[model samples]
Target chain A: MTDWTIDSLVTALRTRRISAVEITDDCLARIDRLNPAMRTFITVDADGARRAAKERDSDLAAGRALGPLHGVPMAWKDLCAAPGLPTSCGTRTRDYFVSEMPCTAVARLVAEGAITLGKTNMTELALGPFGDNAHHGHVQNPWRSGHCSGGSSSGSGSAIAAGLALGALGSDTGGSIRLPAACCGIVGLKPTYGRVSRAGAMALSWSNDHLGPMTRTVRDAALMLGIMAGWDAADATTSRRPVPDYLQGIDRGIRGLRVGVPSNYYFDEVDAEVVTAVREAARQLGTLGARVSEVRVPDPVPLGEATGVISRAESVTIHERLLRERPQELQPVVRTRLEFGEHIAAHQYLQALRGRGRLTQEFLRAVFSQVDLLIAPTIPEPAPEIANVTTGGIDEIIKKMGRFSRLTRPFNGLGLPALSLPCGFSTRGLPLALSIVGRPFDEATVLRAGHAYEQAAGWVNRRPAIG
Target chain B: MNPSSTDPGVTAELTRLSDIIERLSRGLGLADEPASFVTVLEEGAPGDD
Candidate 1:
């Protein structure tokens, strides 16, 4: 039962080997036993989940079929608005906030026959990279309790790692999804900007934000992404392009693929252990008939600065009215950051936008010209202590957040797709991951390479012991 | 006038910008102390002069 991946679970259900209700019950039992220490969920709708499972069972019995994720129990980050669940965004201002209608992504998943377990925890206002929520308390890492679980999708990562949920939806602005996935030893995908809709999810940054899936394996992440991607009327930024069958290319081997490694900025000042692990992953790819070479990234610091400008400017705008009226409602860290956005000059914001297009074109011309994907350490180091995050001091908090997300923010600026997969574990028993980034709208290449590496490395088979 | 130019008009513009930020902080219930604030500018902002 503990060895069940989404593939194995779907096979079991299709063969009539086990009922959906039974699987739901097993998951609920695991949550009951493990959640006290993990604190992954702000709310768990077991009753609702059981009811959905029973209905799926009936459909199976009647031969009225649903989609691929039929009868699967999954969780979503609290930021996603569901009909009856609170979309708190990990802040006290909207702690009791619930929506009459579900977010477009959540509605689509339910329509595909996936059962919703409940909303998981997140960092306050989704601002900090460490998943410590002052309102709902901190979420512990499933692999090691005393350490941090990367945020603001902290609960999404921990829940899947502890088997509390089979899969989860997480929103990433600056490595929120990938960082947690790396820290929790799961597979997280940040699809190309505008590949997934951001209409109903809480907005942190209009330009850089992305919504995607986190799962225990690359194949499962691909399955969830296929269902989630598409154009939506509510979000104009969503591309009108057709959704590709992401799972279709999983078996495609990387025969002549070129993988580039950023030799300068990404490799500098990284933890020795994380650097060693990523180097080993590159070596393995080389042995598997793929060309691996070091590539230069000119001044990634400017890209990082541009990402900050856009994100902070948009965030301040989103909360402008709220900041004016209910100023005391936010956590100190979130409040200070939102206030800092006022300091961003209008011309500076516009200049950042100008630099963005030029930098993206430069990145594509230099790196993608020689390689199919770019590889780097997802995070420079393992999880830091939750207490290290300062409360009201915005500068201190931003520095801490930068440490966790610096490597991934530049890709967001370029509107490219990147996936994080566990490659090895740290000396302290935490996970270290490698990120595979692809060109715009080329999620297929990223997913294919991730799946192939996952098959060769066999890291997906290792599950954290929560009991 | 070049918006990027750092002239006396730009200094006046910075004063206005400071006023807006101060008002925003007051609205967000943040402390008005200078230590809590750090201005972020682009590489070639006129105000940096």
Candidate 2:
């Protein structure tokens, strides 16, 4: 039961093969056993989880059932607010403040009957790329001890990989969700910016931030996205467009689907193993009938620079008070990054904002004209040892941060949907991931391509040696 | 479906005429771009989930 996906749990619960209590207990037991070691959970609400499960069971007995995720247990990245639980956002600031209202994304799932175990850990202020949090303790890669778990959605990724939760909600600004998902060998979807409401979530960079699901399977990602994505009056940025039933066309396959393997930037300086695995994945997609060919993607370096400008500017605004008052309380990495924003000129920020539209238009016209999606490595390399990333000096840390997140940053600036899923594993047994990036608001095609590749590659079943 | 992914149109107008010319040559009309993120947020635009 602990190993089941949301779909599997739903079927078992609806057929009376499993009780919500049993499912909840399995996850709690695993969390209790692993939290001390993995640091995946920042707060564990076992009692509330059990209570929710019991109520779900009672509803079943009374011939009433909750929506899509009824009886399924999941965890949320601490960045999103959940009532009755503190959303630490992986920092000392407002860690103990429990909001009266859960974030709309969390509330949406709660309305659909997804039982929550508690909040998973994240990078402090959801800023860093490595899952090392100076406040809540770092999340270790479930695949191997003392290895990077990836962040800013670190805990959510480790929890799903270790079977602590079936699925979790993770927010992505740059590579938060996708990197963690890649490192942990799961599926992560960073839906188009504004696809999911960010009403109650902790703000990082308002323009760059995105919210989506991290789950064990592609369809599970679809199931969660189906419920979480929609127009929200609470979030003015959310799309007025209707959400699609992502799962409907998911298995339709990629027979004639065009997949571009970038001839330039996407593969540049990427580790040989990562490049090989993703290339192999593109080959697998071709075998699955996708029309695969080489194509030149617009250089994302300029877009990446714009991402930094907007993110730094907006991040400073979000943390202005906390940074001004509690300067000494934040981690050096967090503090340094925020302070850098103060130096960005208003005109420079405005210039970056202006560049976003042009860059997005250029990217769409140039690349998407030939291909429905592009396939590339999610992270340039597999998870480095935890000791290596954490012990570096500030300059070294900054370098590592930029390099690690470089590949995923441009998409955030472009506000395009990108999906990262397991493609293969490194010789050292760390997970390698393939990213399927699609046109703005085209998460369905991204997920469909990923599903086709994942099914043919058969990498989804190989969970890490954690549980 | 979510309308060209919210260009956050406060800066929606191209700052330079040349930028529009570049876009036009690239085959993307002004109409190809969705309205700014602030505008065009009308809920339930066809194909309601």
* Top lDDT hit: 2
Residue pairs in clash, model 2: none
Q: Compared with the true structure, what per-residue lDDT tens digits does model 1 show for residues A1-467?
A: 56777877888898899989999999899888877777798888899999999999999999996688889889999989887776778877554445545688888888988899899999887787788887788989988887789988999999898888888999999889999999899999999887888777888888888999999999999998998998888877787666789888689888789999988989889999999999999998888778999888667766667677678888999878778888888776687677767767775665565556556656666676677889999988987777766454555676677777888887777777899999999888889999999877778889999999999998888888767
lDDT for each residue of candidate 2 in A1-467, tens digit (9 for 90 to 100): 44688888899999999999998999999888889989999989999999999999999889985698998899999978887787778887656435556799999998899998999999998898889987888899999989999999999999999999998999899999999999999999998877899888988998889998999999899999999998999888888667889999899999998889999988889999999898888888888998999998888876677667778889998888889998999898788788777656665566666666666766777887788888889999999888888776775787798899988888888788899999899999999998898877778888888787777888888877666
lDDT of 2 by residue, B1-49 (tens): 0123233321222233224333333543344432363222121111221
Among all windows of 10 consecutive residues in model 1 chain A, the one with the lowest summed lDDT is A93-102
Q: Given candidate 1, what's the lDDT at residue A264?
A: 91
In lDDT terms, how accurate is model 1?
A: 0.80
DockQ result, candidate 1: 0.03
lDDT for every model? 0.80, 0.83
List ranges where model 2 is wrong by over 4 Å: A94-100, B1-49
> Where in model 1 is the C-alpha error above 4 Å?
A94-101, A390-394, B1-49
